[model samples]
Structures are given as structure tokens and as C-alpha cells.
Target: MSDSQHHNEEEQAKIRTSRALAALTIAANAQISVEDACASVVDESGDEGLDAIGITLARGEIYVVQAKASSGSPSPTEVLKFNQGIRYLLDWDWDSLGGKTQKRRGEIEAASEDDVKVIAIFSHFGAQKTDEAATKLSDKLLSEVNSSGNILDFQYQGLRENHDNRNIASGLGLPDYDLVFERWITMNDYRSEIMGVVTGDQLARMVDSFNERLFDKNIRAVLKATDTNKILDATLERSPQDFWYYNNGITIVSNSISCARTSPRTADETFKLQGLSVVNGAQTCGALGRALRENAPLEDVRVTVRVMSKEGHSEDFTKKVTRYTNTQNQVTNREFVSLDPYQQELSESLLSEQIQYSFRTGQTLDYDEHAFAFDLEEATRALACLTGVDNATRAKREIGRMWSDITANPYRELFPRNLHPATMYNAVQFRRVFDERYMASSRWMDTRSGGIIKNSTYMACALFMQKARNEKLDFSDIDLDVESWVSSKGADIYGLAAIVVELHENENPGGFPMSFFKNRQKIEEFARKVRTRFQETGS
Candidate 1:
């Protein structure tokens, strides 16, 4: 092939890879399926700086992605391209663009700018360059977006970024072998806990080696530098000697830990940990690594490290430890589920009944290990359905709102005191069936009108399932009936959903009404009217 052809092929490959990665990230972060994520992505190939475009359904946020598959950092030209794309998006410029770009632009224009959260993601497969030109370009773009009064968030991910990290069979660039410690001190009875001091150089090496794997179990994503991080950086710069006392230390989890102590009585020892990972203190560790890369003076800096073996610990227990250690920092309420004894018991009960249950979001349970597992968001929606919440399905997509309700409501009342494992399983299964049925109409549902109508459809389906199973139906019976009903009347049900969507839109033209999904009486009355209409049609 000619050189031009080769370059084109390379760019095409990057586009394909970046789109796939962006879809996966959306699915994992949004707790949706890979297929759903792909469906949301709009193709705008010739739209200059835009590569992959997706809108997060739950949060009503738009994600504009620019992906570079190169091993080197994105160039100044790439940054300018991204800047131009954002300008077009914000300025509502479409006449200068191609048909596909204009079409996508129209869809975005339908939503009010205030309601939309625009996230610009620049992804590459190597470390991002922070040289003068690149940095200046980035600052200019960021400043323009900031001054535009738009809710725009910029995220840059490189090969070392956690967006690419996952615990898969193929091992997505995670390091192999154990991280060794030259001198350590045991802190527990079973030799599972060890505490020691690590030099700044050693800390940087570990971060470079493990990268995103260090935060495998963390509930939150790796955040940008905040005011807290600034303080830590200043401390590291000025008082390297006081670093150990100022910092809370790092916590790590591993499959096993082996120690070869240099002395019998002294605290000095050499420790080697296998399958090691930092479950907590990701920000602190990340900051230290960045500082070291910038050539910070830290030869004498000694940061405390705690390593715990997961040999005797259940996954649930390990997660709890991570949750507790991270409490000093800002985290989502969902992260605190590990501290709930009822959640732990619920997980255990489900396991005993041969069902896999994960209380945390973004966790993948192998089907071979268990019969069924529900994502936390899915389970939350089911609970909402079972309890007669009007827009219960909406809770599945709204993490902050869901967290608020979860913390405010009594656990016994929100989740029944004597909840049966089978019932919980059935609720999740019912929601899954409903989702599958609705998604089958994706050809229409992927359109703007269809997308607006989708959430109401989900709520309606959940209500339908609840009403069907009201008479103490068995799990198998409920599943069969739901499947049959969906197969026969799915289209009519979706039509009803579209009607509900119209009603809401007409009532509140600015956005979806807050009362639309919250009022139990209103929702049930709408459902009754839909049922009456279905009966009258008698198809």
C-alpha cells in the first residue's frame, strides 16, 4: 500500500478502537449493556475533531470523544481540532458541516444547553504530552469552554489511564507478577497485614508499573487534581520530611503476601506480595506519582504503606475495608453500601440460594461461578418497582438521587425486613425481560422521539410486571407470563409509553416534569388509562 493509504488505515484503526473503548467505558460507568452503549454512539466520521459521540441516558449528559490510537501524545493540531469541534457544538453551527454532522447537531440542539453536561474525552494509547505547545493549546480550549457558561468537563486518558483498565481474561495491559517490598513490618496475626515505609522513587515505580490496576476496587473514577491534591502537592514540595505524618498512608490488597525478614526481633523485613493492588488512597498515590514525574525533591520522603492479603477475606469483606479507608475523602453514597450489614447479608443469602449478587456497581461476576447476578443499579430499580415507586426505573440511571433515597430511607422499609432471595432474584429478572423487550424495538427507539419515550416505557413495563405478579405467582410462572405478554403486546405497550411521553412533554416543555415519575397516583392512573385503551382496542 502507498504511504497515504497506510496512514489512512492507521487512522481508521484508531477510530474503530477508540469508538469501542468509548462504548465500553459508557457501559461500565453507566451500568448499561455494551449493545446499548454502542447504540447511543453517533457516527460523525468527517466531523473534523469529533470521533465518537454518545449521550448518557441516565444523566442526560453528552460525551464527545476524540481518540488517537498512536503510542505518542496527541499533537497541538489534535488539540486545535477538538477546540474547533467544541466551538461548533456550543455555537450551534451546522451549515458548514456535512449531512451526518448536521443531523447529529440537530439532535443535540433539541436539548437545552443548561440541562446538558458536555464531557469532552481525549483518549490515546500512550502518556499525554504536557509540553509548552500542547499545554498552551489545552489551556486555551479549557478557558474558552469555561467562559462559555456551559457545563463542560474535560477528561484526557492515555494508555496509563484507568479508562482502559479492566479485569478481563486477556488482561487489558495490567502488570504481571508481585510487587516486592524490601523492608516491611507485619501488623496482623495471620501475617496478612503489613505496614512499612516506601521511598518516593519506589512509590512512583509502583504507580508506573500498575497504573489503573492500583485502583481496581475503587468505587469512584480517578478524579482530576482538586484543592486537596494541591495541598498534598505543596506539602510534598516544601516539607518532604513531614510527608509521612501529613498523609494518611496507602492501603493495598493482594491475593497473598510472603515475607523474608532480615532479622528475627527487629521490625526490618523484606516482603513480596502477589496480585497486589491499591484498593484505597488512589488520589494520594496518583498525586505522588505525578510529583515524582515532575522531578520533585523526594529522596528522603517516606510514605507509609499497608498491604493486606485477600487470602482469607471474602470479596465483600475486602470491599468493606476499602470503603472504610476512603471515607475521609469525598465519595458517592453508593460507595458506602459495603458498610451496610444488611447488604452484606443480602449478598450472602443470594449466594446461598445459588445466585451471584454484587452490591457495588461496575463489578463483573462470572456466569460460570454463579447462576445469576444483578448490577446494583438494576437491583435498585427493581426494589423501586416492588415498592410502588412511580419512576423507579429513573432511579437506576440517577446515581446521586438514588444514593440520597437509599441513605434517607430505613433499610428494613426500603428493602423488606425478611426479603426472600428468590423474590429479589425475580424482580431483577423481570426488569431484565422488560429491558430486552423494549430494546428489541431499537430501530425506532434510537431516534430522538424514541429516545425521549424510552424511560417512560421502562417505568410502564416495570409496573406491568408488578401488576401481573401481584397474586403471589411463582418465579417460573411470572417469567413465562411476562415473556408471553411482551411478545404479544410489546408494540402496543410501547405505543402507550409514547403517549405518556407526549403528555409529559406537553405539560412541561422546558424539560421532564419532576412530578411525572414521582407521583404514584398519577403514574397508576396513567397505567389504568393505558390498560383501558388496550382493552377497548381488543386487537
Candidate 2:
């Protein structure tokens, strides 16, 4: 091969690697799967100035990347090309772009114009401090994009070395802070905590450098600007100097924290914190970064961060701290479950029994090892049924409200101190069976019929399980017979449920109220009638 051809191939390989790294960074930052990130990428060939595109479904935002793997700063022309690419994306000028870009446009066209658009420029060579012309070009492009009445943001990330990419790939890794100033201080009744303060610029750099991985351990979901966030933004805007006084410091929990104080003369210290994650004040941190990016007077802002060492601390203890620190907002039952010691014990027990149990929301369960794992939310719903909560079947439809109910009253009784993990496990398995059998039946096609059938079937399954437990029968031993019974009697059961639904609808012609189902007495009466009919048919 010619020398020039070999060099071109080498450059292409580098570009491919950089693009893949960029994709991983996007996935890590967005908290999405790599496959999803890859799906959003626009082909490099005939690519209209954009290297890749990533869409965050949860945040309703799109990220367009322009990555350069060169050993030096990206040229002014390269910056201009990046700018032009964003323009094309914003203007929806698909005709001027390649098919892949056009396809991406179509994928995101359903998103509202108000959705956020972030243009990220990634470079192996540092884009900070050097490349003044490139910075100017970026500013010009951002101004143009912002003037178009779109919620747009521009971020320049310079990964100075290959190790930088590796750091980003690890979801919990910290960005390269400008100056790590660490100090040891003892709190009352606790081991000394490592306190560090970073300037607003450094915080902004960290936010721009990494993804949501920083706040991965936080209990609360990513919040949009709330009253609290607004207050934080205002404080940063008006009195950035008093930021430390005005704001409660951020709390971070990590497995280990290390610091090297090189010189007594210099206050700067090099700190390496491993398995680090922000447990509290995620919104505050996010707002600070936003304020700095939006030209808030944050250059002098010094934010204090409290780092608690996770050494000698149990995972449950760390989770408890995380849960307590986030009590300013209404903590969900699922969040509570995640911190409950009993829940952790149950999860471990289930794991030992070859059954997966996820006490945390959004935790992935390996279905191959275990038939299924119940997330706290799903487990709560099943518990609601087992405890005889009115309209327990409605938990499937209104999961959020059901959680609130589960945390209170008759529903909460289901999670008594001495409650066995087997009861909860069996309830989940029964619900899964009901769901599978009901959905598979031909009766599921009709919307009205399907709704009634679902509620009745759940009631039937719950009653059967309760009866089995009362009689001290092996629940799994009767699984085959139960499945057969449900399969055969599904139509008859639905027919009875349909009659009940029709009666309720006729009684209140002004649309059937959900209160009708909330009547436990009425549902029990229907369930008894269905059971009697099934018994007569069997005899």
C-alpha cells in the first residue's frame, strides 16, 4: 500500500475510535444504553458536518456531536463546519444533508420545537485555553442558534488523552478538575470528612466534561427548574459571592477518597476520589452548572462539597444517608424500599434462592437466571393485592398512585416486619401468570371486555393464592392446575365480569366511575359469583 493511503487509513481508524468514544460518552452522560447511542449516530460518509446524534428520550433533548481526534487543535474551518452542521439540524434543511441526517431529522421531528438541542464538540487535543479563533467561531454559532428562538446549548469537551475517554466510559468517573483543594475536618460524632471547594468555572467544566453519571446515586430523578432550582439560579445570578452561605453544601458518597498535598505554600491539592457519586443536592449542582453556562456571575462562586467516605459503611447505610438527605422532596415508596434493611435482606435471600429481586427502581433483572425479578414498584403492586387493598388490580394501570397508597394504610400492612419474602415472591409470580394468561386469551382484543377481564382475573388470582396459603398448600405444586383452570374458565370469568361492568355502567349512565371498582364489597360479590359458576361447571 502507498504511504499516503496508509496514513489516510490510520487517520480514519483514529476518527472511528474517537467517534465510538464520543458515542460512549454520550450514552454515559445521558444514562442510556450504547445501542441507543449507536442508533442515533449519523453515517460519516456524506455526513453534513455532524459526526453523531444522540436523543435522550427521558429528557426530551437531542445531542449533536462534532468530534475531532487530531493531535492538535481543531482548525477554524473545522469549527465553522461544526457550526454549519448544527445550523442544518436546527433549520431542518434535510434536503441539503445526507440520508442518515435526514432520517435522524424525521426521528426527532415529533419532538416539540421547545425541546432542548445540545451541540457538543469533542476533541482529543485540548480545546480549552488554546484555539481562541475556534472559541470565537463557537460563540458566533451559539449566538446564531440561540437567536433562532430555540432552547440550544453548546459545549466544548477536550479529552487531552486516551485515558480521558476511558475515564468517561466509566459512568462514575470524575472529570479532570482544574484544581483539587482538599481539607480534612472532623464533624461531630463522625469520622473526619474530606471537604473540597471548586470554583464555578471548574464546576461548569465538570458538568460539560461528564454526563449524569456524577449524580447516579441520587434518589431523585433529573428535575427541571423547580421553585428551588429557580431560587438557586437567582442566588447565583445576584449574589454569587455569598453562594456558600446561601446554599447548603453538596454531599457526595464514595467508596474511597485520596488526596495529596504536594506543597505547604500552595493551597491546591490533588485529590482522587473513587466510586464517587453525588448523593444530595443534585438539582443545586445542575442549576449551578446551568447558571455558569448562561453567563451568570459565577466566576467567583465557590461551592463547598462534603465528601463522605464509604469505607466501613454498608451499602444499606449509604443508601439510608442518600434517602434521608433527599427528604426535602416527597420521597417515593420505591425510594423508601431501596433503603429499607428488610428489603435488602429479602433481595439477598431471593438471590440465594436463584430468584432475582430488584428493590431499586430502574434496576435491570437478569431474566435468564431467574424467570423474573420484581422491581420495588411491581412488588408494591402485588403486595397491594395480597393485603386486600380495594381495586388492587388498578395498580397495574396507575402505578404511581398505587405506590403512594402502598406507603400508607391497609396496603402498608402487607410489608409488616415479619412478612416473609416467599409471600411477596409468590404474589409476583401469580400476578405474572394472570397477566400472561389474560393477555394471551382472545378476549384481550376488545378494549372494554379486556379491562373488565383484567380486573376480575387479578381478583380471582389473588383470592386463589390467599385460599392456598390459608390451607397450607404448596402454591407452586398447584401451578399447573391453576394455569389450566384459568385457561379454560377465562371466557366464563370474563362473561361474569362483563355483566358486573354493564350493571355498574347502567346504574351510572354518565360514564362508569372508578369508584365502582374501588368498592371491595362489590368486587368480592362478583368474585364469589364467578367462583361458584366455575365450581358448578367443574362438577
Winning candidate number (lDDT): 1
lDDT of 2 by residue, 1-539 (tens): 12224457777677666667667656655554456666666646556668678764335366777666665667788788877776556545566666777776656554422225564654445544547788788877665545423456766666554356456455434432323653334363122256657666666556545445556435435444343555666678878888878677778777666655332212455556666667887767777767756767667888777777778777686687788887764344346555557778878877777779887766888888885577776787677676653546445334444434445654457567777777678777666766676455525444443444444555655655554466564444413344454455456444545454554344422221232343465556655655565455542
Clashes of each: 0, 1
lDDT of 1 by residue, 354-398 (tens): 778888755787689886777566676776666554546335334
Q: Which stretches of candidate 1 lie over 4 Å from their true place?
A: 1-331, 360-364, 389-397, 400-413, 470-492, 501-505, 508-539
Q: How accurate is candidate 2 locally (lDDT)?
A: 0.59
Model 2 residue 529 CA deviation in Å: 68
Identify the runs in model 2 with alpha carbons over 4 angstroms from their true place.
Answer: 1-61, 65-115, 120-184, 188-192, 195-205, 217-220, 261-272, 294-304, 316-318, 330-539
- Candidate 1, residue 79: Cα displacement in angstroms equals 28
